[model samples]
Target: MFKDRFEAGERLAERLEKMGPFEKPIVLALPRGGVPVAYRVAKRLHAPLDVIIVRKLGAPFNEEFAIGALVEGEPERIVLNEEAVYRLGVGKEYLDRVVAKEREELHRRQKMYRGEENPIEHLSGRTVILIDDGIATGYTMKAALAAIREQHPAQIVVAVPVAPPDTLSEMERLADEVVVLETPEPFWAVGAHYERFDQTSDEEVIDLLKKGKERTEE
Candidate 1:
């Protein structure tokens, strides 16, 4: 178990550095939980940090169980777990509502945190390291990978502090490289791996992004 997001990030940075000489690398973090962790990685890697906003589309009955994810991209992106949607018998109406709600939040977050940075277009021909605190269902990560892939990045790396074994297996195929600190079997939840897992607020995320931008400039 990790002490906190900072500790986990520091450790993750160590692992990332060993995979050194990352060419024209840029770090894209999945906020708000990912900001702090990705902040550390960006600082250590000496790379510019940006946010990749994604929202999980949960099942109709149980919102915790993700059926798909909505990712904000140039044309926007949606990745669905066909099995989950078919099994749950989700309809177009429900999916449309969820997508609309998530898109609104994604746009709001982009404006509030990014302030017109326009980092997505720069992904082409650059190595992109996508970081998150951890993975549960992996729907969000999958969506993020798909969206980033569309931008034609030189390579895609998925880095996380902890994730289940099965999720890591799936990511191996999606990402050019995968860095995970822990893959605890019978994983309970992402928060369970951290001793001090607290909710990261929008204010915190914005502050970190600003700091990351400054660090990159220096």
Candidate 2:
């Protein structure tokens, strides 16, 4: 098991270096848990770091059970679990309401994390390395991939510390490459694999982003 996110990030960065010689790479993390992990990778690679804000769309009664995911954009990108919706008998009205609510939260997070800074506008022809703490159901990451695809990036690489094998398989179909440090059998929650799984605060995220920006400048 990984000691913490920073250690996990170090190990992950080591693995990524072995792959070697990426073309005009840029690191995009899934905040807020991803910022710290991505920061380590960005520092190691001397790459620019940014966040791709994606939120899970929870079920009507069970907020922990994700039915879909939404990613921030001019017109936000969404990916739904059709089987889950059909099984749960979810209606369009409910889905619409949730989308609106989640979009508002996404905007709030964008402002809090980025302030007046603009998002990276030029992703075309660059290799995008997408990072996160770990993957659970993988819906949110899928939404992130969908949003990134629209930008016409040269390659999309999804990297994380740990995830279920099945989830990694799904990611492989969407991304050009998938780099994972661990895929434990009988997988529990992402936190179960980490010794220190504290919630990442908004202020921590802001500070990390500031540091990441400075890294690129230096």
All candidates' lDDT scores?
0.92, 0.91
> Model 1, 37-99: lDDT tens per residue?
999999999999999999989889898899999988778889999999998899999999988
lDDT of 2: 0.91
RMSD of each: 0.9, 1.1
Q: In model 1, how large is the Cα lDDT of residue 201?
A: 97
TM-score of 1: 0.97
The TM-scores of all predictions, comma-separated, are: 0.97, 0.97
Q: Compose the digit string of candidate 2's lDDT tens values, residues 1-218.
A: 99989998999899888886788999999998988899999889888899999999999999889999999886778899999999999999999999999999998998998865545457888889999999999999999998888889999999999999889779999999999999998998999999999999999998898999987887
